[model samples]
Target: MKLTASILLTTFLSHVWSFNGELAELECPDDCDCHYFRVNWVTDCSDSNLTRIPYNELSPNVYVLDLNDNFIKEVEPFPPDFKVRRLQLSANLMSELKKESFAGLNYLIDTDFSYNQIRRVDIDAFDDSAGLINLELQGNPLDDVEGPFVAVKSLLYLDISNCSLKRLNDRFFENVTHLATLDLSDNPLFVINNNVFDPLSSLETLKMNNCNLTRIADNAFSALRNLKNLELSGNNLYETNWGVVLENLILLEYIDLRGSGLTHLPDGMFDNNQYLRVLILAENNLAGLNIQQTIGKLQNLDTLDLSDCNLTLPLSEDAFANATKIRNLYLSGNKLFASDLLLALSPLTNLHKLSLSNCGLSHLPDTFDKFKSLQELDISHNPLNDAFVKLLAPLETLEYLNMGYSNLSHLAPDSFSKMTNMRRLILSGNDINNLEAGLFGNLTHLESLELNFCGLRRPLNATLFFNNFTYTDLTELQLAGNPLRVSKTGPLLPKQLSRLQTLDLSNCNLTFLPPEAFYHTRNITNLILSGNHFTSPNDLKFLELLPMLEILDLRYNNLTTFSPKELTLNPNVEKLKLIGNPWRCDCSVANLWDWANLEKGNLGILEGSTLTQEHVSVGKTKRKKLLICNYDTGTQPFTIVMNKTVPGRRPFLNPQRTLTATNRTWAKYVRESGCEQQPSLKRVVRSADGYVSVISEDGIKMRYAKHGPNTWSAAAINAAVVYVTLMAIIGVAFLLTKKRRAAVRMVVTADKRN
Candidate 1:
């Protein structure tokens, strides 16, 4: 019932908007927030540490006013018929905008003094407000645009980007002649002379990106005749003449010129942009030009991004012979071959997305009978094999196919029998193992199937999705790094995956799941058994036959306790990933301390037990949250309690840190930090304020805090003797570069139990 008529029309518009008692007698001020939105009344004193401007007389239908981030230094004067229509004083400490500074906001239409320390903007400051139409003086220092927009003549969007603007004289937009979107990007303005945007004749979107621009003088955009999107990307614009900067953008439809180092793109430079539809010259240095004579007269060009232009132009067949109506073509990081990608994609016969990924393509010459309106094809990380899957089985209007990593191994059973409108198949990092059974039995609209790192080790044959007839719109199945085992002629998935909804068998060393694995996958909802080897929580009874399981990733599994009968299997499992498990905190982890402090499930732990180098620099930093186990029976035999969070130290010899929570108290500071028997304290480095750094097994020879029995603290023994004399001069320059490594094989075994 349309959510019960959207909850009875939201309780009859919250009782007809409380019959506007003027926003219910508008008193919300002391640290503001007054509601009533649709058609006026919104106060909200942003970040309430406000230092002013809580101006009076609001609710005359208070039209949206949010005095942004406080300590406001001055944007006062409001008190008279204050009719605000959108005004957010951004990050404040306002410095100037004097003259009638928004005199009564004549229904001010949008004004955000961006991140302010604004260095002045007097010039009749919007001359008694003439319906200000979007004005944000970006992070101001304003290197003189003189007379700050001489009265925003119906200003339609203006953001003096970064505001260190170096040039732009021709009366700097004279009087904001109906400006329509102008962001002087970053601003150093190297050059862009002539008619300097002839008073923005209705300038329609122009962002001088990065602005180190080399040149663009001639009639500088010929009066932006209703310019339609132009961003001169991060510029040095290698000798940019760009045919007098694109002749006069005949209603130019999008142009990004990414990274601009342009090696060549002049000839007819987009012959009068025949309605140029999206053209991004990606990371430019157009290797040796002739890439379709730089956008072959853009005959209504539809999306063309020359990816990482290191292109060595060999592509012939008239390159893109007049860009035959290009429909999405990004030559991913080009270095083409295979008949120069079939003569640069057989003239993009209306290509519907074609990306020759990492173009060192191993094959694909038959060029899918001229891409019959190709519908998404990315030859991922190309080195391709499996004869590029029978050369994309003649892409019968291919519906998204990405041969991921592309060193594909086997799939010959009619290799995707003429891609029956395949709906999304990415054979991930292919080394594909086995599967010949009606190979994708005529891909019945295959939904989302990614054979992630296919090294498939048997057992997954429900004819790939219930054979004997037909029914395979397989919903999102990524046999993640396949090694799908448990084979005594039993389980490895496919027990009728009744429309499986995302089932990624992560790092498959998975130790078993026979009991009807996902019993007909009752529409399994996101179940990625992360880095497997499931070690009980009763191995989660194949997720209580998945009652639409809602995300359960058992991250790096070996589970130590999530037991209370695996928390009743699917109490609407709402995301649970026990991070790199080694969990066993005794007494059966007190039944997961109130189900890991439930807030509707989202638990992931790896709190601590060893793995440090900041946990092997986990994913190069950022992934942290997942710590639970509390078990504290006030001491004696049950004490896996940790509260005074730890992980400290950092003088930066780069032993890595960043794990927080500390206030001492971990069992009375580890028995007052005596570091129990320091036989060169074999590595502790603990600290929750209770300190501990017993390290002495030749870590460049050191010792600090040596755990509290006091002695180290002369600035921690002079920062561990300047990080052990800079790791003893980089360990004697890495043992003299490993003794002039000319023939350095090894044979230095010694520790026979030390």
Candidate 2:
């Protein structure tokens, strides 16, 4: 089961001055930089080492002001007409929030004052900033009296968690009545007074998780009628009967009570939560599970997570008799016997995703076919061998299957012939070395196949994808950690993987690859060939066959220098992984170094800002490994010649890595790494008269190299052009000579007459 949570981790953002719509440029404060992000004018002043907020110097129309991680100690009032919408002031040194600190910022909607040394917050601090909607006061040591944000009556979201809050006074939220979400997690709040949260009648989500909370008055949350999501996980709620505490919360939809050290879930604890859809009771020390009382009363429960509850089975056949509507059930990390587990789960035919990993099972019940609606199944970390092959073939509806480290040894050739609907299959960490011909031929819809570390000993051949003519839809294939090396006389990759986009063959103990190794893989865009034994970039000649290749990973190879000339040949490739190699920052790498500077603006696109801290570009790089130069050239001034022009003819922006690009780290290395090139060697020409001589552009002789590859070169077109140009020059000379002769004859006749 996948759990996804989005926590807003506000980071430091340096600002530049620009309007949102027209993006008109304006002078920014010396301590700030601003840019237009999405639909707002964000001016980030973070990490600027400023002692105070640049309120007077900021743009009047700035919508977002980020001053995080600065040396500011006080919150000064903004300009009277400041229209800032989101203000971030995390990691500051302020000790107290004084009144009128944010007086005139009527347009401020979201603000963060987290991680400050604030020991007190005056109740009137937010009286003038009534328009603020979301407030964060986390990571503060606010031991002062409560009722701090009583003035932010319009606040809708508040995160006062992790503030070392021991207790909240009765009037803590006296004026904030419209709050929809409150996070009080990661605090030392030990007790809850009666009717403390009774004022938040409109609150929809309340999170008091991980607060070391031991006691709570029954009336503490007695008035929150609209509360829908109650997450009280990671707390000590063992002292109270949570059923009585949550008896009035009728609108609760999702409850996470994981790791609360409860021995049993009292009957009807969630009986009043008729709208509950998901219930998580994982990591609890429950003595015995009475599912009929835990989930039987809920008609809308769709997901139940009882993983790691130390649940053992001999469960009654009717344990989940009334909870048949649950579709996603997670029983992983439990030690249920295979037979008893399958028997208990047999009634839930509507299950779509079931995770039984680490359940110590050696077989898959053929009865799984009864769950015709099941799509995703994970049985990893079990001892199930090939005994479960045919048992799983009946589940035609399964789309995703992960059987990693299941002690699998071998399977029949047509083991998965019936699972044509499978989209992703992971069988990594097994001993199934040899694959039969047409093994995956029937899985036409498979998109991702991972077989890493499967103990394959022989070089791959066509039989791996043999007769799989319709398997072109596979986009990702990870065969790393296997010795799938190349042999001189072995078979090449089949053309069936023509449409494959990403292929990983890393750590494959590969030393050499023939030039035509991947000649059939034309559309692969991402290729991982890292952790190999390639000593030179020339060993990557097979890349020429991958015209559509873009991202190439060559890390941990025995490479010394990657010639920029190779990069010039492969223009489509952009993001390169050359880390973990002994890279010499010299003439052989200078052009690539310069090229990477121009290209690095494309990396780190996961963030809104690119790596360059300059202009944004398209085609973001996905690799996170930073390329470092291993050989540090000393500060000695040694002369080295650089090529005036790169060999290939292409535009300056794209293929040519020789373009002048800025590298902020260039000062650390010697610029004299640019060295001179050897003089060009004269080609040997074998003349038609049987004598060898130096080559000329004239159309008589054929040139030979010091080595031969049993291949011939064609010069038909170039030879024809050279011959035509020579003929035209001779014709022009003959015409001029004829005219001079005629003039001389006329002069001689005239002299004879005299």
Best by TM-score: 2
**Candidate 2 root-mean-square deviation in Å:** 19.6
Residue pairs in steric clash, candidate 2? 14-44, 15-33, 15-34, 15-44, 16-33, 16-34, 640-674, 640-675, 641-675, 641-676
Model 1, position 5: C-alpha lDDT score: 45
lDDT of 1 by residue, 98-117 (tens): 86667766777777777688
**Among all candidates shown, the one with the greatest lDDT:** 2
On residues 1-754, what C-alpha lDDT tens digit does candidate 2 reach at each position? 0111111111101111111012355434644545545535667666557789876668888877778778899887777788888777778899988878877777878777888898887876777676888888888987846454557788898888888888888788888888898999888887777878978999999988899987777767789888899998898877776777888888888889888777777887887888899999998876487777677878788998888888753566777888889899988877777567667788888999999888777787657868899999999889886866678888899999998998888877788888889999998998988777777777789999998999876644567565547466788888899977467642256777777898888899988788777776778899898998989877877777787877888889999787545655566665777767776666555455444422221222212221222221111111223344544534333333333433211112221222122221221222323333222212333222233334322324343333232211122223334445545655666677789999999999999999
Model 2 lowest lDDT segment of ten: 5-14
In model 1, the Cα lDDT at residue 272 comes to 81
The parts of candidate 1 lying over 4 Å away from their true place are 1-144, 147-216, 219-241, 245-316, 320-365, 368-412, 416-721, 726-754
Model 1 earns a TM-score of: 0.33
Candidate 1 steric clashes: 2
Can you tell me which runs of candidate 2 are displaced by over 4 Å?
1-22, 29-33, 48-57, 127-130, 148-150, 431-433, 452-461, 480-493, 504-518, 525-754
